[model samples]
Target: MWKKWMVCVLTLILSMPVVACEANPAPESQPAQQTLPYRIEVLADQLDVPWAMDIASDGRIFFTERPGRVRVIQSGKLLSEPLISFPAPFISEGEGGLLGLVLDPDFANNHYLYVYHTYKEGEVTFNRVLRLREANHAAQIDKVLLDKIPGSSIHNGGRIKIGLDQRLYITTGDAHEPIIAQDRASLAGKILRINLDGTIPADNPFSGSPVYSYGHRNPQGIAWHPDTGILYSSEHGQTAHDEINRIEPGANYGWPVISGEQQKEGMKSPLLQSGDTTWAPSGMTFVSKGPWKGQLLVANLRGKQLQKISLDATRPDTVLEAATLFQDEFGRLRDVVEGKDGILYLLTNNRDGRGNPREGDDKIIRLVPIQP
Candidate 1:
């Protein structure tokens, strides 16, 4: 009886599954596994080629439609009418129209807003950055500051932001002319910085000009690191090598001559390269003061995803591609910005005639990061 009992006990023990546990795992330790802690929720739909966005102090999100209207979203609903609309002369063909929008740092006091758009003058035309103030009425325009800068219907780089130094920084594309990127006299394919009143800062690299850095090809997204204060930009590559670069004053980012990491003397290589056909990156935002703090969030148009890159540990110099979310559901993500409440807001680009749209197409999505 004892031998039979022993055999049965041995068989039961052998059949049970075995689990290996670490001898001294910390009680509060998190697993090393990487995961996306956000749930993407669609806020509103039926937008047309929405390019960029700025969140107002009152939590209203204002964004631009490439065809010349600026719209707002409040409390999960899109406003019925445009806040402001430009004349037809300000809207050009392909890559032109109302492109970028930013609020003045002292907007509460000055009520100033800036915009970048393509304008026409008889036969000659150019992309111009304009500053306007809110008139006594909410939807009226008051002023224009600094207009005319050389434009093309195809490659108008229209991204503007106010830097920590209280200066406006603008990113311009190559205007489909590769050589223009290297021309010091041309504003095409360059990053520029200027004072709020539209004057070049005396501390700028180019004495009397707003040129901060040169040699870019269709740069769309610009963001500053939370800890380092260093600026990071996303560039669109022609056929290959989409890049993310760390911006420095007077530094030249190679455009037509070099795409990725070519050993050139004066050019700076991208910290990360998307390579040929994988990603066409657009607007980016850094997630600060959350579980995702220190991670760079990038919106991809062609790839149709929101990619996160962890850069807090490094000096914003290393590029580590993290979990990509919302690619299959959103169609194309154009711009991403972090809300004051720690939620991530995304602008979908499906209505731009370049993506496949479903029932709720061309929408603004809010992603709330959840605790894992």
Candidate 2:
């Protein structure tokens, strides 16, 4: 009877169930296929080393050629006559020239245009910021906003942009003297914020100077977030460590002192870094309105392509995605700006001595968004 009971109990336990330790979850679904939503059109060709461009509120597109000429494209027609030209002593050497340009916030009434370029004083050469009056034929220099920032052949950071706060911001390279980037008294290797009249902003981080932030190394591209109003900058590292940083008041971006993967207290790290690859990023623009709205369109010279960086809506400084656009289709892109008409414009740097210039080298191309 006992043996029969044991057999029955064993059978009951065996028939209960077989339990495994853990069950495997199914694999996550693959991401959706990315479809680019823009078609390129040749807006203007034969441009010689176009560096930066901005569309005026009056729908006039003004651009700068590195050889010291400012050309206008009105009503989609490239004007045969040059709008303005810089005279002698404005040296176009190495990585320097008439680099950054911007129209005034009140340009319609004020008629002010600002530029950052390399200039010579006696035997000394330096970079400066000038505000000029745009007239019918030529522009007149109204004010020399800031001058005598240290300049070098290669590291003369000459990109400027107006922030949402209506302040003019400029980036300066270290003049190849990395030590100066850490000096608060010097403007080299720093991001400067100044008033429209080229005076120091009352609320600047520096008490009486225009030094907004310090410790930068050849920052070239700067733009403001349309939503969050934060400022972003792209800079070149020594050999590696191409970086994208969000600028803030009194912030000291780790440069000269440190590059990437190295952090210290009171020093800020970059948002994104290209570990060992050189993007050689130049001018960048934030798409204001279109299918690619809120995205940053950056021009890469060494990379010879366009990079579209998607910003996190909730955190504008956070980079959500980054992809190369028109890879090698246009050689050595230099600048990108969004037109008021919701079209994206790109400037090629093929004529910049280092690039492979095609037939109509260094052209201006527009990116037309595809409609669903």
Candidate 3:
């Protein structure tokens, strides 16, 4: 009877479940990871080195191809024929060609468009800003707004935008001459502001001069903050120190003298820099809606990504965070613009002689933000 009772006790002890105690217990839950609010969709494909773009109030998209073609997309379709083609045989080697296109603020009434392109006169290379008139689905050169900007096979900074004040802003590179960036007299390496009629603003920082700000190496993009109207510029830095700067009138950005975080007494440092990383940032725009509103999106060429930059809410000049999206998904992004409907439009520059082209080569892509 004792042996049977011991066996029963052993069986009961063996049948009971065992629980081990952990030194540190995990929390009940973990925070979920956050994701981007938009997905990319291809709007048009097979484009040839599209450089810059702008959307019209009627939903028409006007863009410039590096090879002197101005194409249009209407009703969600890219037209087979270009709206107008700038006379070729111009200098398109490297970064020079037909670049920088923007529609007039009063385009609906005036049907005016502005463009910047490289040309040669008597063996001298130069860049000019021209106004075009569009009628009957065709455009012709209307007037030469500004001219005599130095151009080169590389470092021909060409990006144009009309500000809220109705003044035209143009970015010009140093034309491969680094020292000219500090010379206020040179049109190269400068941000120029002019009236719609191509006249220098009376309130310009320099009287009778179009130079708004100087000391830029190769500034390729410029955009104004949606709420503050503060202008920002994206510049290609020497030795992988790409910069995004808050532009002030007559301010010196210190191109060759200082880059990245190096500061000088009278020069304004960049709001954000890539440090050792090379973004080769091109066109940039501010988000107007959704979770990413007030942030800036920059298209990177060599980095082949769309860089999202957040700024401090209290300090508009301070950069809060920097992140990237769609890395290597598209080859060589050139421009990103916010559409009138609060969506984003992107351009791929694979065929620009520097990227590995995919099957479709170049494309126009759209990003629709996910609503809450």
Candidate 4:
């Protein structure tokens, strides 16, 4: 009788689904005997190509549409009208368009917002960082802080953020010109920093130049570590070796000089590399102040997944473990931002030329931990 009951129990258990707890499941040596804590929820849908986003002071989500609109999601709804729209001069070519967005540090008081986008002049098209003033539900164009960044149909690096130093940092691609990435004199293929008024900080690594670091192929993501205040970047690789780098002032990243397995003198090596695989990483952020606080969340474009990179106990230079989330479930992902309320907002890039879009395809999905 006891043996018959045990057999029935075992059959029931075998029919149950296995749940995962660890961000990355343990190796076969040690199994994962746990259940995942969080669940993903779609906050809004029926949107266009949502690229980058920033949490507004009032808890609203401000995001950019790759075409040329600055949109908002308020009270859990995708607002129909855009906060502001740019002219048709914006070239929505291959990779060029309205790309990144961020709010001023003192957005509550200043109501200023910034964007990184691609614009054309006669025949030449390039990227620029523009500041705008927000008031009464609308934003007005302000200073063109930085402009004329080298751009191309594909490799237009357009991630911008306000660093811990209270300065604007912008990343630019090689404009498809691999040679310029090694040129210190060119702003293309470099991370540039400037004051709010578009002036170069005197304390910059390069005294008079806005270049913070050089020798990059097509960097797409930049975020600061919460504990150490160190800057981290996500860069795209040619055939393989997508990288996450620890940014050091004036350091070279060895773009055309050395790609995948090669590293040279004076060029700082990346903290992590995905060999023979392309994450095609985009906007990234750290989950600061949550159960998964220190984990770095990256949105993968071509890989069509959300990846989590965990640091070691000492929080040193190396990644301890890595895992994927929503693998191909939502198509391509463009940005992942952690809101002040500890919720993670993931922007879907399904409407982009390369992705498979459904009716009302692109969306912003919110993730929250399911507490025990």
lDDT of 3: 0.86
TM-score of predicted model 1? 0.86
What is candidate 4's CA lDDT for residue 294? 92
- Candidate that scores best on lDDT: 3
Q: What tens-digit string does per-residue lDDT give for candidate 4 at 242-298?
A: 878889999988787665555555666677776677789888998886677898888
lDDT tens digits, residues 98-132, model 3?
99999998888899999999988877788999999
Deviation of model 2 at 73, angstroms: 0.7
Which segments of model 1 are wrong by more than 4 Å? 1-35, 135-137, 312-314
Q: What value of lDDT does candidate 1 attain over all alpha carbons?
A: 0.77
Q: How well is each residue in 326-364 modelled by candidate 1, as lDDT tens digits? A: 656678888998888888888888877678877777788
TM-score of each: 0.86, 0.89, 0.89, 0.89
For candidate 2, write residues 1-372 as lDDT tens digits. 865665574344334433322121112222224776788799999987898888888889888998898899998899988888899889998988999999998988889989999977887779999999988757888999999999878798999888888999999999998867877778999999999899898999989989988889999999888888788899988887777788889998867766754564566777777666778888898899888888887888888778878778796556777777777889898888888878998899988889888998889999898888
Off by more than 4 A, model 3: 1-33
Decide which is better by TM-score, 1 or 4. Answer: 4
Once fitted onto the true fold, the runs of candidate 2 whose alpha carbons sit more than 4 angstroms away are: 1-33
Answer with 2 or 3, whichever has the higher lDDT. 3
Candidate 3: residue 239 Cα off by (Å): 1.9
